[model samples]
Target: MNTLVTGRRLARELGEWRSTGPAYRALADRIRVLLMDGRLASGTRIPAERELSGALGLSRTTVAAAYSKLRDDGYLASVRGSGSTLVLPGLERGDHAPGSGLPLDFTKAVTLAYPGVAAAYAAAIEQLPAYLAHDGFDMVGMPDLREAIAQSYRNRGLPTSAEQIMVTTGAQHALNLVTRSLYSPGERVLVEQPTYPHALDTFASVGARMLSFPVSQDGGWDLSEAQLQLRRAAPSMAFLMPDFHNPTGTSMTIPEREFLTAAATREGTVLIADETTALLDIDRGALPPLACFSPGVITLGSLGKIAWGGLRIGWIRASRDVLARILRNRPAQDLGTPLLEQLAATSLVRELPVLAASRSRDLKLRRDMLVQLLGEQLPEWDVAVPDGGLSLWINTGTMSTSALALAARSEGLGLVPGPRFGLDGAFERFLRLPFGHDVEQLRDAVKVLGRISSRVGPDPLRMPLQAVI
Candidate 1:
């Protein structure tokens, strides 16, 4: 079945899309960005021109012109009886690949593997033979791995048990299981305003009605708004990243964490805290995990960031009852996490402190290098230095990152526009630049940004394509 995007939803997604250029051209550009960023599925049917015109308060001719422009660029396909459908030229329908096939792909916020990962895998292989005789289908993690994961939490001052841990393929998979188990058809899910885009995708997959609260780099999480939403909406689940938030890279203050957890408890909202990037600490010391504040908070942790992205090991730390619910629903999606990966994960989890120390040294060096390069090249841009995490959240002031990303692609650079992290087309002027690359790559990326920064100004649509490319 083809997904149909409503006119109102389209308008919301096209937030602040107007530029100094013609409205038709601006609309077409925004739609293209949405399709390129995987915000809008290619095979989905968009609203009719007249319906979209009504939604945007524009004339039908303007909407028709925009649709015509999209068609001319091979982004929209219209049929006589069927509605206009979005399409990516030269790519199959629903083919939203991760990178742009460009050099310097900064779309993902990940880091180089910890140097000790290979040795850990080797160690896991030595121990794997003993467990080879079993069925090896591990829905709830290996006993040793679960205890190690639980002990890692206990090391952080949070009491946890192997009984509370259910291993999964990765943090994203764990989130899928959590959402499928907890979220009903129409229940609202509250999330950070600018959060992990894949988390938004996971929630949307279940047809969830999502509400948002802000988490700014300057002011941190908006607890006031979070409390308001919790009280008013009474959402079933609230997804959070209190430690080293993905795009923003801001960790919540102890007071902020306490307040939010207390508020969620009051409203009976289940807190789903994603600690995927929790241990990516640079300067920031250990703060208590969100699970410490509330027993109901379901925390998701993975080795993908700390150890290596290839290590598909993540676990859900929730109450035993919640684990039971997730376990019951787990078989519908996936059977078990790979046993070899689990064995490797157990070794890594035990050596997490050593891995974290190594990552911290490397990340700090790269983070400082990227910040210095950006300071030298793009001095006008506001770049906040995060204490930890893989990326830097930048405020490009008036520049539309969607337009900037389009221009960057021509320069052999890949960038994720800010709106990809936001809801309702927010954060168009913001950008998340991952600083996990080498010093040379960082220097080249900055040079590319510096070269195109002036070209992609406040009015991205008005920028001459010939000049940018």
Candidate 2:
């Protein structure tokens, strides 16, 4: 018996229904469920896009997109000859946890797309139908979009080129591409302790000799000290989030960036400046890209935080030579980003004001609301009012964030403890809570946390919040 339904099954079930989403996702998700449960055996060919789209009265592009997501995740494989086949290959714990159904998903350091973006995406689709006759894999990107991104960088006082850009699936993909191309497994990689969780995770998975440098809540970094650590650890490469650094929401000065880039350059190390969170800054001025200070740096940027995480779009700005290296590394890990998402992101980038204004209003409100709520409800917790970014780094008096996290998870709250962001459990006394959620949800969450915090004794709360900055 056939397990996962082919597109033919969806055609039969929907029977020329023209509705979008709800119905669209139902068909896609049902197939995913079957594949996950081992019902969808490998080597089964899904129906052709034209056939299914016509049969269900759905746009071919929509079906194509669902297929694209599955393709990206390694769930389905397609080639010029073989058609798509079922292949949910990974066996991982996080995969089993599933998507969030709650009003608040603090774990996401990303913004939800604006309501009007649907129209913008639809516009891209309308535009795509016209372009279908041409070669789709224009690897560098749509030229207009490249020029737009280059302009954005220029606006921020950093010089860039369309040639320096390569559109990617997201910041994660961009970093991974750079990492794979720039350094080999077992290479020494230096990272900020209490850094973006995925960076450490990525470095470690590559079997790199990973070293963690300190970053502070009150003190960002002292150059001389960091230089010593760099000399001592002798890392082959480093990943940085210089602008509005993740989880901690710290921003580096131009001087600091210059010093860091110089130090890394002198040490003969490649600096991967993950600028994924750069533009969300509510701060007063522009902080130029670390690449401005050193030509030898790889910088990652994305539409995720600026436009929406659903865009699944990011880019790497590096020299033309490094771009070639990243291209050679691409096929081993990913083919390339889905063409549709890239198109949508490109449109979104051109409409920069809409995206920036939406981000500014939403994030500013959410950030302010969170600060007030935490102050009112969890007065005992010492939380930093960040300069920018979606999350607040808390100096949780207690070192055992695991206890609070476990306690919170029981109440349907996902707490990303500082240790998850740290290499040596050094941020044991720190905790990260995203201000990305709305006021009501943040209020409720703080109440839940405050209730949990109330029960802990003074001793557990008195431990010095370690600064692994």
**Top TM-score prediction, candidate number:** 1
TM-score of 2: 0.77
Instruction: Look at candidate 2 and give me any clashing residue pairs.
Output: 214-469, 215-468, 215-469, 216-469
Q: Estimate each model's TM-score.
A: 0.94, 0.77
- Once superposed on the true structure, which residue ranges of model 2 sit more than 4 Å away at CA? 1-103, 456-469
Q: Over the stretch 123-154, how does candidate 2's per-residue lDDT look in tens digits?
A: 77877876688777655677767778888788
Tens-digit lDDT track for model 1 on 334-353? Answer: 88999888888888899899
In candidate 1, the residue pairs with backbone N, CA or C atoms under 3 Å apart (3 or more residues apart, or in different chains) clash, namely none
Using lDDT as the measure, which candidate wins? 1
